[model samples]
Target: MPELPEVETVRRDLHRLLRGQWVKNVSVNKEKMVRGSTSLFKRNLRGLLVQGVKRRGKLLIFSMTDDKSLLVHMKMTGQMIYQSKQTLVGGGHGQPRVKRDELPNKYTHVVIVFGDGARLFFNDMRQFGYMRLVNAKQLEQVVKRFGVEPLSKAFTPDKLRRLVRGRKTSLKNVLLDQRGVAGLGNIYVDELCFLAGVRPMRRADKVTDREIVKLHKAAINVLKRAIAARGTTFNSYRDGLGGEGKFVRMLKVYGRSGKLCVRCKTILKRVKIGGRGTVYCPVCQK
Candidate 1:
């Protein structure tokens, strides 16, 4: 699944390309890929002008005229590709890769046509992604379901401390909770913990105040760097321009289990937390 960085990358590209363009048509190849009535969904999108694209957590919000929006979630194996006569750009899980010539390929479950004949394809190899049509009120409710955006003004050292207070779960699990920290995933949790010199398995309440400050800083630093690098691509991730993220090379312990730690020369170890593989350096993190 594309995390905040990857999703935000896509949102940025799409917002730039799709904004001000009128929806020429809406096609739903797979009914299950859409959340509401297919006809209503198509009706709501047709002819609507895309006002902007916004993201909260991993959800992409396409704001359009008439108080309508498209809420898209590229769950695990989904990809959003935009194509015009002059450009082709997209990003998501890159599995079952799309052949440019054979676009609207078997994996493309949804396609949005713009007034200029450009098209946006929503492809999912595993059919786990979804698109929903929503009104302003519905959009607000959806946004409210997520926690603080790490990049937003609402997230700070004090806010981070409050969010983790009283949590008995491992720091990994606490960070992964979307209700607490909106955009963190397994990859980032491991990296941030390592950067903070803390163990992912440490209990949230067990973390010291000083450690909280470190964690808060590390979280922002890691996320900002990852976003700047376009995000980490491991097997199945691409950026908005159909490019792989360069951040993978900067990863410390996320996928480097059994490797030597850069800081302490200790061997990195991997463990299962909340069913997700987590890697850390025992010596450095201790």
Candidate 2:
């Protein structure tokens, strides 16, 4: 799954390359994954001019000229590749590396052609992603479901405390809950836990005030650094410019299960919490 860093990188790149470009045509090969009526989706998209691109949680919001926005969720295995006459860029999570010759091969399900001759391709090997068009009013209603934007200034210590109050779920689970903290996923959650010296298995209600402050700072720092580096790319994930991220080299304990911890020399441990694989240093993290 492409988490906050990967999604934000895509949003930034797409905004730079796609703003003000008119959608000339729409083609959908896998109809089942599209959310709204196909005809309505195509009609709203065909001639609309893109005003801007923004992201909330993991969703991409493409603001259009007619007050309608295009919402795309690149679920697991989905990739959005953009190509113009002068440049080509994009990559996503879950699919194998996209070969230069193999693009638009079989996984390319949706293609949006622009008036400038540039094309945006939405590819998903698993067919679970979806694209939908919504009016501005409906878009507001949709965004209301998302919780606090973790990167925003509004996410203060009080905000963090309020969300964690009386919650029995593990701290990692609380972070993963979109209704509590939008844009956090398993990968960054693990990194945040390790950075804060908090155990992923620690219950939210049991977190101390000192630990809460550390957790909040850790999340913000990790996200900001990851965004700066573009994003973590293991196999399939890529930035909107089709480049890989440099954050994987900075990772501490996300995937190094048996590796020695950089802090305490203890073998990092792997545990499954909420069905997600979690890694941490036994000595460094509580």
Candidate 3:
């Protein structure tokens, strides 16, 4: 699943490539994954001019002309690839990597042809992704369900404290809840817990104020660094420009279950929190 940093990198890449470009055609091969009838979906998107691309949580919102918005969620194993006469730039899942010469292959479910002879392909091997067209009102309703944007100015330490106040759920659960923190997923949440020196299974309400400050700072720091590096790419993930994220090399806790802790020589441990594998330093993290 593409998290905040990964989604943000895609948003930036698509916004730069698709902005000011007019959609000349739309093709939908997998109708079941789209919102409406295949014909209607194609009609709604065919001639719309893209204003820009924006992201709320894990959703990609493509602002188009005529007050229309195209919302796409690349659930899991989804990739967005943009190809032009001169360039091929994109990022997402890499498994069965979309060959530039053999595009619109077996996995491409949606293809948007632009007026400039360029094309954007949405491919999902598992076919779990979806694309929907909405009016401004619907768009507003969709984005309203998300919680605070962690990269926004609104996510302060006090705000984070208020979110976890009186919550008996594990801190991991609280952070993973999109209603509490919009863009955090299992990977970043585990990393955030390790950075804050807190156990993932700790009750939210038991967190100290000082720990809240550390959590807030860790969230900001990790996100900024991840975005700067594009995102974490393991086997499937990649940046919008089709480059691997450098942050994976900088990771300290996530995916380092049996490794030595960077801060302490103690071996790290992995525990299941909310059914997700969470790794942390038992000696360094509470």
List lDDT for all candidates, in order.
Answer: 0.90, 0.88, 0.89
List residue ranges in candidate 3 displaced over 4 A: none
**Whose lDDT is greatest here?**
1
Once superposed on the true structure, which residue ranges of model 2 sit more than 4 Å away at CA?
none
Q: For model 3, which pairs clash?
A: none
lDDT of 2 by residue, 1-286 (tens): 8889989999999999999899999998888768878877987789999999999998999999989999989878788888876777885673566656565758888889999989898888888888889998999999999999999998987898899899998988899999888999988999999999999999999999999999999999999999999988886566777778989999998888999987888999999999999999888887
TM-score of 3: 0.97
List RMSD in Å for every model shown. Answer: 1.0, 1.1, 1.0
Model 1 CA deviation exceeding 4 Å by range = none
Displacement of residue 187 (Cα, Å) in model 3 is 1.2
Backbone Cα, N, C clashes tallied per candidate: 0, 1, 0
Q: How many steric clashes does model 1 contain?
A: 0
Weakest ten-residue segment in model 2 by summed lDDT: 94-103
Winner on lDDT between 1 and 2 is 1
lDDT per residue, candidate 3, 37-86, as tens digits?
78888998889999999999888999999999999998887888899987
